[model samples]
Target: MSSEAFRAGDRPVRISVQIAPQHLPIAELRDAAVHAEDLGVDMVMNWDHFYPLSGDPDGLHFEAWTQLAQWAEATERVELGPLVNCNSYRNPNLQADMARTVDHISGGRFVFGTGSGWAQRDYDEYGYPFGTVGSRLDALAHDLPIVRDRWTRLNPAPVRRIPILIGGAGEQKTLRIVAEHADIWHSFVAPDELGRKLDVLQRHAETVGRDVADIEIGNELRGADDAKAAALFDAGVRLFTIGVSGPEIDWAPVERWVRWRDAKNG
Candidate 1:
């Protein structure tokens, strides 16, 4: 695992909220993001999907990058981005440029969370080829360098070396990509499952010549509490994201996690 395996716990815990982009008015979504920032979340996020993942397939939806542009301007302190952008949807260079623009728009608070992409519906309905999983991952690997190089060439430059957050638990390709390019690696594994995955991630990191400790670990707070947070913390997760949907925004769980974060950090 090298020296990087246990380093994530040294950083302060961060709380993020993923406001799902479906079945709600744009105004409501905007307001929810604003409110979350007001409540002191360390980050705010939205999903990158053309259609709703649940409820109605044809429900109201907003585009990811455009909404993020708006969000960049809306919140003042919280970091922001798509929870996990589908790499196949946009050109790599274009993706890099958009990320740079958003970084500027957010005054350097954007976190580039992306994945190889799943969801056959997004591809079939949008005219993208729903190729095999291996193909999509291959696309992600090919594009990431272009994205990074584009960032280097952009005018004015990004305010900071924008953090790249890669989401997925594919022990083979995804973790390898994370080891190569990501500053943050997000996963949706159970606490019990995390140790094994982190072991896999560290082994992949070693193969890529990266110190696994250099990457921050991100996880979802789906019904998570103090105990779950403690267990994940022990397993090396530091950035915790909570998923919330709209019509009405809930604060209880968010506050609970925030308190847990502070306690953990303290």
Candidate 2:
């Protein structure tokens, strides 16, 4: 996180859309990506998972990085990447290479969002070690530096310093990692919970000689309510993402968020 605090006045609000890759055809996902970009979203995201998180466990799903490669080539403006990739799914070096390639494909429009692995089913079904939470977070702690180093060493290095977004709220371990590595911090907590977590993250930043303000706060827009979005914006969250899951992709909520974003920016 950077140390420059965001002034409490008017700031540009960014809206993002997360497409559930599981349950939607590639064509439909592509269409959604185009729609999101046309609708003026700041970024578009997809989750990294082998199986569907809802509806059916064995439903249609796509791999994260592979889909991102396609997305990077398909869209022209909106930044794209996983909402948060699992650190356990791939070796850090490989992940860095893949991300670098996608960054080039997108002409430098990529955000690398990653986190400690969770979801026991993803690990078990994919033959990855379904270790305890503590152990997985420990692995993530060790891998971040390796990923960073590999990113620096890769040939045709990333177009720019790709922003790193870390998603998690583990005060003791996860926030510390965010302080050390993240340019954006995503969480699903309520306003008060987010405030507390921000405090913890700030302390970690201080301990690491980093500034918490460098990290952009991210959250999901659960509804089209202006009041709710305003509360979140006032809490220091500039990047707000709303998720649309398939068989049918809904854009109404997304449109509302976009309108809210425009209002804030205007």
Candidate 3:
């Protein structure tokens, strides 16, 4: 591992897409992921939900890790992982092992993006307790260290120090956890709202004794027009993600984001 520290805003703008594994044939989903790489996306992501978040309540959907393993083998580049895994679904040790295995399969192009489990329907149908928000966040806070420790103890460790991307913007608990653990912070707040959220994150970083500048800022590209994206870029968000799904996946929006990324990087 490089001794050089991580710094926010140091990297050029990178684009990623979450190919929602729902409402589409598995083959199309797989091809969409490959096509994302072909379109010049920096990362390929999938959701960790049992059912579709859009379209029919019960639609064609696939599990996250299985697809990730397949993606690791299929794509030559572009990092792969869940947009934000539900930590409650698996034991922290198991999560560590799985991520490490995928890291190896991808030849070090894997990111471990996670969050406290949400969506009550998923828990109810899947037999997990739909715990209160506070409890779930507490569980995530507790499990993260175990995951990190498990990574260290694994026989053949990860191909590299897998970047931990924590997706959430809760000022109280989530930001604090991100301060202590995350290499990347994925926030859902719009550009207008992001400044205050980042202020809160900075305070949390101070408490944890890590520089806020060391954690990369990430946001969604869905509703971001070019002007909105430029605002986010000016605000120090280094990564932008857009979500795509279906039997007929549209690459137009994706290509636009890629162009925006290239222009910004240039």
- The local lDDT score (0 to 100) that residue 170 gets in candidate 3 is 89
Tens-place lDDT digits, model 3, residues 1-266: 11123344468888989999998877778888899999899999998999989888788999999899989998999999998999999999999999999999999999999999788899999899988989999999999999999999998999999999999988899999999999889977888888788888878888989987778889998866989888887777888999888856778899999998888788
lDDT of each: 0.88, 0.86, 0.88
TM-scores, in order shown?
0.96, 0.96, 0.96
> How large is the C-alpha RMSD of every model relative to the true structure?
1.5, 2.0, 3.3
Model 1 clashing-pair count: 1
Q: Which regions of candidate 1 fall more than 4 Å away from where they truly are?
A: 1-4
Per-residue CA lDDT of model 2 for 158-240, tens digit only, reads: 99899999998888999899999998888887775666777788888899999666678888887637777777777888899
Clash numbers, per candidate: 1, 1, 0
Question: What's the lDDT of the predicted structure labeled candidate 2?
Answer: 0.86
- Please write out the lDDT profile of model 1 over residues 207-248, one tens digit for every residue: 989877889988988887778877887788889999998656
Ranking by TM-score: 1, 3, 2
Global fold similarity of model 1 (TM-score): 0.96
Query: Backbone clash tally for model 2?
Result: 1
How well does candidate 1 score on lDDT at residue 262?
Answer: 81
Model 3 CA deviation exceeding 4 Å by range:
1-9
Residue 22 alpha-carbon offset, candidate 2, angstroms? 1.6
TM-score of 2: 0.96
Question: Residue 206 of model 3: what lDDT?
Answer: 84
